[model samples]
Target chain A: MASNIPEKYKTLIKNNKRIDGRTLDELRPVKIKVGVIPSADGSAYIEIGNTKVLAAVHGPKEMFPRHMINEDRAVLNVRYAMLPFSTSERVRPGPSRRSNEISKVTRHALESVIFLEEYPGMGIDLTLDIIQADAGTRATAITAASVALAHAGIPMKGLVAATAIGKINDRLAVDLNGPEDNFGQTDMPIAMISTNKNITLLQMDGDFSKEEFKTALSMAKKAIEPLFEAQRAALQKYYK
Target chain B: MTLLYQNMQYIRNNIAKNREDGRTSEQFRDITIETGIIGRAEGSARVKIGDTEIIAGVKMEIGTPFPDSPGEGIIMVNSEFSALASPDFENGPPREDSIELSRVVDRGIRESKTVDVEKLCIEKGSKVWMVFVDITIVNHDGNLIDAAGIGAITALLTAQIPTINEDGTLNREEFVGSLPIKEIPVPITSGLINNTIITDMTKDETECSDAIFTVTTIENENYCAMQKAGPSEMTEKQMLDIANIAQKESKKIRSAIKATVKKHKI
Candidate 1:
């Protein structure tokens, strides 16, 4: 019934292109700043196009209350918080189902690359707070979390990065912005470890052909390469 | 209610200046309104009064009309005050502050008959348009009632109604016209501090006040809504003064709204 509703959005993001003039397979310009918070062991501020998020890591410490210890490996704690003034519509300050789900999946995405055995029975806390949101928040949260973990000197095989591939007007587009994500038919967010190209996170909704899925996955793999480079450069810049 | 002896003394001594910042008792804080800021809503505006900020959005939908008012559309007002705005505010369902704000805003719009609901009726007694106005407090310096009211009305004034298809389905991408608003309602709030009445109370001023008064006017002369809050007593003369000041101040705010609509070409 709302099929005719997204025509403006479709015209804005024509086939193989986005509203901001980027090609379908291209990623948004990402900037990452490491060690932004001196209070946290590790912290990173990241911006993917217009979306901005901050991640902080505090870890390898005894689990609070004592009984929640894992005994086998360090526990990963993830939290996603959006500032009340982050989006155009003020969001109530608290964790909603969306944030809870993002926090859980974000932990899973980073868990695959983290060397948890190095800090047995300790706690590793990661907080991803959104300062400004345009779209693709979960993907940027994972990207910043991975960078914050590396900055914290946590043991990890490789840094992780994420991006979204969405279908708009029957076209596969990478890094959907706010309007595109809202109007588009399908949205898929993917997270991967850059070193070995292992897909640690994958999620999608809406219509997609088998061919579209393969093309989107390959595009995500290639899109994360430059993101991986940006991650390393952020840490390197801080060290210097 | 927190009228400490020292603060009370300060307010008495500063009576000549109207406030610590030297604004006249009837003067309002700086007003700034930016429309169409929310991408998801049909109509949206972010308004700021000095340091206090609020955002308002209007969402339109089609639903069955009320049994008695089948030909008239519905307008629902709601508000939120998150902890981010102030430590005193909690995150949950609507609190007393939010409910009061919404009710006051809603009363003014309803009493003024701003939107011509009869025009909103898509089908005589079965289908009608519903307009929802949501106001969110971003910063709580003070006078949230006025800030939210302005935000809501501004958003509504700028809101566009989507085109209805032949089958009555809404075409979200294409908006046909602005909501059928009949009039503009502007609100001004005043508070009593140290026995003196003040307009546009700041957070500090509101914290120590005994009574608060708000008046909403339409076309600069008609009273649409009025509210009195807090535990302090209000003299008959004080209430009359509030009404007078509100009537005078509303003209300026209404002009501002008109300028905004003109600038936005809505």
Candidate 2:
């Protein structure tokens, strides 16, 4: 492995290639299945190529006392779990810093999309399980989980779509895979309301030059169109 | 609430020729197990039984080898009793009851030898992967053994080990799929209440039961471990009857697990 990001990223950029062999804007295959778990109020099984996420929604129930009960808005509790064997190496059990960060970001993203104010004093729990992982887990979870909530007939403002853009060798690429992610100089995951283009969650790891960041942001926004369509197509299959 | 008791009594009075929930005593609650949840962990699963839900994440790490078992990987099962599920659990270290729960769940999986521990060694006598199976009780309705066992086994079955290079580096493209376990272990708990052995006891039944009998197995026919809990002593006939229930019900649970594994093909 290259010790520094600049050297590795430069090699990929110079070769006109990505670590996963995709062009700068290509995405892995996205497959979404709705209502996999019969017990949950609503559930979805979404596979973004090798990265698999299962999102279940249970809610609009009375909130427990002692916890912060939102009388004017519903609470969203999202837990993101990646099975130890979801990757090539085993990970430590419990919430790591990365997982915790993603969980909070995912919660914020979905909370913005869901019409929580309509179900005041109740809470809706969203659980996202990553059975297989390659990259783009948080983005995949946010996308799938929103679709699940909408399918559950919980009032949702609009669909939220997310994708990551990163700087690899001074080049901007949308949707970084595991290898590119590790070696990339910067990664920015953006969650947006596809309908109104509202930004819900934004997280970036590593630094990007201002111009490079702007290019990546443009690439990420452009990448959302197809994903938004696909998410719509999935919910339509179940709801319509 | 009154209607609930009426239904319970209706089922109880007809116990001789009928069963609670309209099924035979030798029956299990509907079970659903899904794998590959939690992307950061190597393997993860969520197992549900009726209203009870448990999520288990198996994480692997390379650490200094234990002195006695330098070549073998260590399996550790940690449990979190969340007050979110029940008021009895306060936020702190695991209580004695939770500890006992963890021990019992760990014993079943460990004694079954589900994972090939020897293969987890990266450097013999220097470093080996410590597989941590963390089970979180999201809801505590009843029969966590089956839920935990299902989660643990499914997580193991879906596990993938990254290919390690000679210089102790992980080659990103190469993956060894799934832990090589000789057999998948299935556990089911049966409760004896009112001199009756019920398969897949509910929380209420468990709370009021005289004793509880739990049997763990690789399949319906092959046995790995058995646990008996509760207060009431069992007669010889009841033991035989309960064993028969375990033997019969084990097949159903085993089949469900196998079908799930086959469907997911992790």
Best by TM-score: 1
Q: Model 2, residue A98: what's the lDDT?
A: 53
lDDT of 1 by residue, B1-266 (tens): 33576986787667656587788887788999999898778898899999999999999999988765767888999888978998778799775557767877887787677888888888878888999999999998988988888888899998999888988788877898899987888878998877788899887788867667777888837565666565333444566677778878888988998898778754
Off by over 4 Å in 1: A1-240, B1-18, B166-168
Chain B global fold similarity (TM-score) for predicted model 1 against the true chain B: 0.93
TM-score of 1: 0.51
**In model 1, what are the clashing residue pairs, if there are any?**
none
- What value of lDDT does candidate 1 attain over all alpha carbons? 0.81
Candidate 2 lDDT, tens digit per residue, B1-266?
A: 11355655554455556555566777777888887777777778889998889998887766877665677778888788888866556888765446545665776676566677887777889988788889999988878777887788787777777667888776534576667677666767787666677777766556656566665655525445544454334443454455566567667766777777677744
Worst lDDT run of 10 residues, candidate 2 chain A, spans: A1-10
DockQ of 1: 0.01
